[model samples]
Target: MKVYLWVDKDIPNVYGQVAVRAGSIDEPADFTGLAHYLEHMLFKGTQEIGALDWAKEKPMYEQIIKLYDEKAKLRDPKKDKAKRDELTKKINELSVASSKISKGSEFPTLIQAAGGTGLNAYTNFDQTVYHNSFPAYQMENWLKLYYDHFQRPVFREFQAEMENV
Candidate 1:
C-alpha cells in the first residue's frame, strides 16, 4: 500500500476528511439505504471524537434515508423539493450531535495551512472523495488529515455542511 501522508503544516488552516474504499456502486442489494445511508452514517465517528449518538440522531438520519429514497423515484420537482427539504431539516437538527463536518471548507483550509491554495471535491456513479494537490513542499501535509479523518471521522454536520454547499 502507498501510505499517503501530509508532510507540510505551515501557514494557517488545516482541514481533513476521508474517502471510503466503497462507493454507491458497491452498495449491497436489498438494502435501500445502502450507499447514501452508509455515506451519511460514515460520519458517525470512532472512539476518538466520541461514540456515535445514533439514538438521538436515528430519526434525522432516517429522514435523510427517506429523502434519498424518494428522490430516487421522484419524477415531480415540486414533491421532490418538499421531500428533500423535510429530510434536510431532520438532518440539520440531528447534526448538532454529529461529526459530519463540511468537506468544502475543511479541505481548502488544509491547502491554505500548508501554504498552498484552492481545494475541492466531487462525486460520480462509482465514488466520491476530498481531493487537493499542491507544491511539492506542501504535498503530504495537504493530504494528511484527510486520511486521518478516514480512520476516525465523526459525521457531525452533514446536512448543515450540505446547506452551506
Candidate 2:
C-alpha cells in the first residue's frame, strides 16, 4: 500500500514516504538489530541501480560471502592467525574485484539528479520509513526510483554497512 498527501501550499516540493508496519519490536529476540540493518542495506542498491555489471559482479559478491562464512568458523584470530589472515586477504581481493563493477551510489544520485531532496529512511520501534521530497514536477520520477528500490533491492556493501551498525 502507498500513501500520498498532496499539500495545496505554495511550496514547490512534494513530500512523501513508504512505510511498513513491521519494525524492531516485531523482530525475534535473536534477530535484534535486523530491522535497522535491513534499512541500511536498502540504500546500498537495487539490482539495476547500483550495479555497473551484475553479470561479472555477482560471482565476486558470492565469493565474498563464502569467504566470510568460512572465516566465521575460525576461532581466536590471535591463535588462528594464519587462517584468519588468509580468509581476510581473499575477502579483500573479492571486495576490490566486485567494487570495481560498482556504481555504488546510483540510487540517491538518480533521485538527486532528478530534483528530489531529503532522500532518507529510518527504522525504529514500530516502523521503518523511507522518505523523500521532490520538485512538484518530478513526482513521477520519484515514484519510479522508489518502486525500483523496493521491488528489486540488492544488498550491496554489506560489510561496510555492518561495520557502521
Which has the greatest TM-score? 2
Top candidate on lDDT is 2
Query: What is the C-alpha local distance difference test score of candidate 2?
Result: 0.84
Which stretches in model 1 have alpha-carbon errors above 4 Å? 1-21, 28-107, 162-165
- lDDT per residue (tens digit) for residues 1-165 in model 1: 244545455634444434556666775676544555545434433333333344544455456556557556766778577776766566545454343332323434545666664454444457666554456655466445555546655454445444443
Q: How close is candidate 1 to the true structure, as a TM-score?
A: 0.43
Taken over the whole model, the C-alpha lDDT of each candidate is 0.50, 0.84
Query: Each candidate: how many clashes?
Result: 13, 0
Residue 150, model 1: Cα distance from true site in angstroms: 1.3
Candidate 2 regions with alpha-carbon error over 4 angstroms: 3-11, 68-86
TM-scores, all candidates, are: 0.43, 0.80
- RMSD (Cα, Å) for all candidates, in order, is 8.4, 2.9
